[model samples]
Target chain A: MILATSLAIAAMFAAGAYLMLKRDLIRLIAGMILIGNAANLFIMASGLRRGAAPILPLDEPTADPLVQAMVLTAIVISFATAALALALVYRVYISHYSVDLSRLSAAEEQQAERDEPMTEDLRESVRDDTDGEASPDGRHAREAAIR
Target chain B: MIAVPIAVLWFGGFVLAVLDGTRKPAAWLSVAVLTSAILSTMALGITVYQDGPMSLAVGGWSLGVGITLRVDMLSIVFALLSQGVLLAALIYEVVNGVGARIYPAVVLFMGLGLTGLVFTGDAFNFYVFFEISMISAYVLVSYGESPRQFRAAFVFITVNLLGSVFFLIGISAIYHTTGFLDMYRIRDQMPLVQENPAILSATIIFVAFSIKLGLFPFHFWLPAVYTGTRPSVAAILSGALANIGTYGLIRFGADIFPRELRQAAPVLIALGTASIIYGAIQALSRHATNEVLAYSAIGQVGYILIALGIGGPAGYAAAVLYTVLNSTNKALLFLSGSLRGWLAGAAFAIGAFSVAGVPPASGFLGKMALFQVGIAEDRPMLVALIFLGGALSFVYMFQLYRRRTAEIEAHGSSPWGAQVVVVMLALVILGIGVWPDPLLNLVERAALSLPEAQVP
Candidate 1:
């Protein structure tokens, strides 16, 4: 039983990690769920003991109930987290018309693009100064220099 | 008496959650709740200082069976710090008028969450309260309802969830090894555990917190979130939310896993050095106020890590003091940087100077504490690094201040109430720097709360 549970947890974690590497928002969320469940399973496995249920009258060695309670709490937290993630993804899709992480990054990339002209003008001026002081032909005058 | 702070926050948070936070009355009501929570926390702190750590078992269960609500000097200090920052940010947001309907309620819940997590003695309960705060933060990140904010929220949520998982795994491992869920019991049982599992769990917990702290290696999500969020949210993130990482590290590392912390000191110092240098360079290269401050936040946390690495009474005291002062500095900077007018600019300059470790600001004392630790430890390289980091910060902060001054006329003036909050925060920073002895003793006393780190 222990071997099976451990293998199952490892497999879930592996698949979850693989999915988390994808750019698709839905896939990323799926990966989150998978890994969350894996952690829950691992928690359960941590306190494994084959015995009677922990109930009122104790006549024998009982299985640890604490890990079970912890797993349940973790499950609820992750459920809420997944729900929040899904809502955020929907909001992103509404705003950007896409669920891809790369697509979401395009807006930021464009903002950076808007700042490029200033840097380019500075680089050109610096290169002009280098031509006067040292040699423009000098290698490594400024790696940022425009040709 | 033990549960008053959490009770006020939790009940207040729920009642406020149903109201429109954008309404003026609701906003002030939330403020009232937070103020009351702060007062109660201070009352608790007074009793704690007079006597000793106070504790309560929920439902009156025996030691290990039921969850514990522990209020030690360390937790009280953190609770006060978190609640104070939240109040400042809340009032600032309210004075500016909340844009979102849920802002005030979310901030209240964040207060409750921070207070709960710090006060809890059970590991699992800590995770539960940690989630409460993180979820509030997730909502807070997207407060502006813009594409930029949503994108930033996505990055923040995804990365931090992984950190949460790491923390959960570490807790489970600790339980498996120690056979106890309560922190005090776990601390007692930890040393008897085998070296391998103890070190493994400790390392996992360390990585989890370092991610939260946005140290050198795990800092990718920070700049995006801080830049995307509003100023009040940024202040809360750095000043209030980041305390989780600091407090968690001190509590779990120095308190529970002293041997492991001793073993990991070199790694902590190395990472701290890397974080300081990386953050400084990044801040220097950035032109945006939020971007520079984001990177600066990363840099400042490095000093706290270095202090933690030093260990013992002085090291722990230095870490606690630096965190408190750093929180105030960050809150003041974020709040003041967002406002316009000459007064706001002066406030920003004060924050900038404090960050740069100049005199008559709380930040200088934080630096002095770390420097004293280095001198006592006789590590000249550490001393040199602190000086170097301070020089780098000063240059970048001067650049930011000059830019703010130049752009003062470009934008319209902000609200006076908000500016007043910024100035008040600045005054607190200055006041602390002027009278460091009491704050120093408070932090030293807080550090002495740890079992092995008592000062002679």
Candidate 2:
């Protein structure tokens, strides 16, 4: 039973790692879920294969109580992590129109236009070339350049 | 009596903060609760110093069945350090008006979890407290409401959850093999299960803890997650949460699985050395203010792993001291970043120096002890790697300092609150560096309580 469980966990880990490497954010979340499950199985397998229940018994010796307690803790932490990841996914969808990484990079480039300078020195250079009044602000210059 | 008051204060404060809804009252309530917690922990420390270790069993179930809270020199010392760092974080938040009611509640709960983590003897109870600490941490990290924060918290939660699962699996396996939950009882039956099943269980446990500690190969998520969080959260996570991993390792790895750990020491040491170099290189290459500190923490934790891998009283003491110093200094650095708008960059630099083990700081003192332990263990190569790591820290911290100071000079001072915290934290760091005897003695006494390993 332990051997079978270990193999199942190994398979889960392999699949999770593959998904984690994918560029899509959703896939990454899936990967995390898989990995978390795999780890849970691995920890559960640590106890010897055929042990009594961890609860104390009047007639029989109790199973290892420490592991049972630790498992309970692990479960609670894992649940919280899953909830947080879901919220992050929602954030990604709202910010980027699309959750695609490549498209998001393109959006950032478009936003870079706001940082360009429009000063008197640059306006003077533009005026000498075109013999036209400078817009005083970079907006006209950028509009003209974009056009 | 002391424990009851502290515990009640912590739980009550948490409840009150949740009920108050208003930010100010919750913040003040949290501050009052935490202040008292700190005082109580100090009182406990003094009592422990005078009376030695003390234990109180809940509901009279004796040692094995009922939950037990034990305060030895070690638990008290860690509690004190945690309290001090939390207080600093609280002050920074209060001064900066980052004082959401939830922030204070999360902190109070985090403190409660940490305190409970140190004292609880029941394995299940340990998990309960750990979750209490970590769930609050998840909230705290994402408290900034920024996209970056959301992303970071997501990653942090994912990785840590996986680690917790591994921890659970390991614990369950141990239960199946041993039929006993108590550490004292587990030790007695250890010799019976020293074969294949135990070895496998030990390996699973190691992986779980290694991930938690952010050891090499498993530390990929740490730098990014830490860099993205708020400086206060980052400080607490780097300083306090990270130490829990090492503390768990010491408790489970050394105490519960001694023979297995001894057999696995070389691999553990190798990983430690790799992390030292890896984290240092990553930190040195980073130009981001927070990333530098994040990487530095990774490297510092590596040093603790090395100390644990060495497995002796001296090594254990060094590990304990490293935990204390690293957490405090890291908190100081991260908190300073939040307080000073102009010094964010400089605070990172100073933090890098403190964490990387540079001279005239607690980090340096901690590293010196770790290196001494390495030398005594005859691992000259490990010692060299540690020094090399320290050098990398110096380079990165200086680079960060120069960059930030130039920026500050260019922009002028931004805020006084941040500057004040930075100055105060720097003084604490320096004081600990120059006069570490008192702290070192506490760590040494704490280390003595662990069952002695026959030095191989």
Candidate 3:
């Protein structure tokens, strides 16, 4: 039983790691779910036992129920997080038009480049040019402010 | 009374969750709820100090059988710090005009989660509260609805989920080896556990927290999240949310795994030194103010780790003091950095000076405490490292102040009311630095809550 549990955990973790490395956000969430389940299994394995029900009037040895309760709580929490992640990924898709992390980050990088002038020497130019709506620095400042 | 603070936040969160927090009344209501929560936590702190740790076992079960909610001096101190930072940030947002309807609710829920985790004595319960707070943070990270925020949220969620899994694995390993979920019971049974598993779990737990803390090696996600989010959220992330990492490290290391901490002292010191040097160098190169502060946050926690590595009563007390001081300083800087008024400039300067360990700011007290620990241990190398880290911080902070505030043409933007709040926080920090006796006594009491460290 112990051997089987260890092998199962190892397999789940391996698969999770593999999927987590994928570019797609959905795959990443799936990977997280797999890893979360692996942790749940580990909690159960901690108190693995062959026994009667954990209830009153038990005449035989009872399996440790504490770990079961913990695993249940963990599963619920993971489920909620997964839901939130899915929502966030959907939002990302809507805004960036890509679920692939590399693509999304590339878009963000371009945006950051455009906004870079809001920082240094451009600050004085932008502030002074605020009166000139046609000024490129003012345009960048307006874009930066909108964000 | 033990449950009042959490109850207030939870109930307030539920109510605000159903309302439009962008409106004035709802925002003020959230502030009032948080202020009441802070007062309750203060009362609880006094109660714990006078009567020792307050504990309640759920459902009328025996001490070891039921889940426990315990508040000691350490827990209450952290609770107060997190709650206070949250309140300040929340009010800053409210005064600035909340951008989203769910803003007040999410912040309240975060307070509930942080307070619950600090007060819980059960390990699994801690994980549950941790997730509660983390999920709210996920939503909060993307509050601005910008494309940059979306990317930042993705990275933050992915990295933190991985960290959480590692923590869960460590918890399961502890339960398997020690057969207890209650923290006090785990501490008692830890000695019986064999060396290898104990060490493995300890390492796993350390890595998990290191990720949350944005330590030198695992800090890839921190700068993006802090820079992408709005100023108030960044403040909350550094000032309030990051407490979990520091609190978890101290509680698990000094209390549950003292032997392992002792065994890994050299490693802690090495990692800490690397973090300080790396973070300082990175901040020096970053031109953006938030990015500089983000990297500075990473560097500042190294001092906490170094103090923890020193491993004595004075060391633990120093760790606590440094953490509290750093959180306030970061909060003030992040909050004031958004405003353009002269008041905001003065506030930012106070925060900058504090971070560089100058006198008349609370950060000086924190640095002094660490220097005492280093000198008392006769670890001249640690003393030298502290001096070097301080000098680098002074330079970066000076650079940041000169670039951002010196050319302030006029109150550029943001409301004067919001600017006042930032200045008020700076004053509080300056007050603490000038008269640090009360804060010092609080931290010393907190350190005493840990079982006395075994002298090597």
Top TM-score hit? 1
Q: Is candidate 1 or candidate 2 better by DockQ?
A: 1
lDDT of 2 at B301: 80
lDDT of candidate 1 over B1-456, digit per residue (tens): 879999999988898889989999999999999999999999999999999999999999988899999998999999999999999999999999999989998999999889999999999899999999999999999898888889888898998998899999999999999888899999999999999999999999999899889998999889888888889999999999999999999999988899999999999999999999999999985767888899999999999999999999999999999999989889989888878987788888889989999989889998999999999999999999999999999988887776668678799888899999899889988999898888888898899999978634
Q: TM-score of the candidate numbered 3?
A: 0.93
**RMSD in order of candidates:** 5.2, 9.2, 7.9
Question: Regarding DockQ, does 1 or 3 come out ahead?
Answer: 3
**TM-score of candidate 3's A chain against the true A chain:** 0.73
Candidate 3, clashing residue pairs? none
Candidate 1 residue pairs in backbone clash: none
DockQ for each numbered candidate: 0.46, 0.26, 0.47
Q: For model 2, how does the per-residue alpha-carbon lDDT over B52-102 read when each residue is reduced to its tens digit?
A: 888888887887776777777777777777767777777667656653557
- Against the true structure, candidate 2 reaches a TM-score of 0.83
Judged by DockQ cut-offs, is candidate 3 incorrect, acceptable, medium or high?
A: acceptable
Quote each prediction's TM-score: 0.94, 0.83, 0.93
- State the lDDT of candidate 3 residue by residue for B232-344, as single tens digits: 99999999999999999999999889989999999899989999999999897566788889999999999999999998899999999999999999999999887887888
Residues A46-84 of candidate 3: C-alpha lDDT, one tens digit per residue:
884657668978889998888888888889888988999
> Model 1: number of clashes?
0
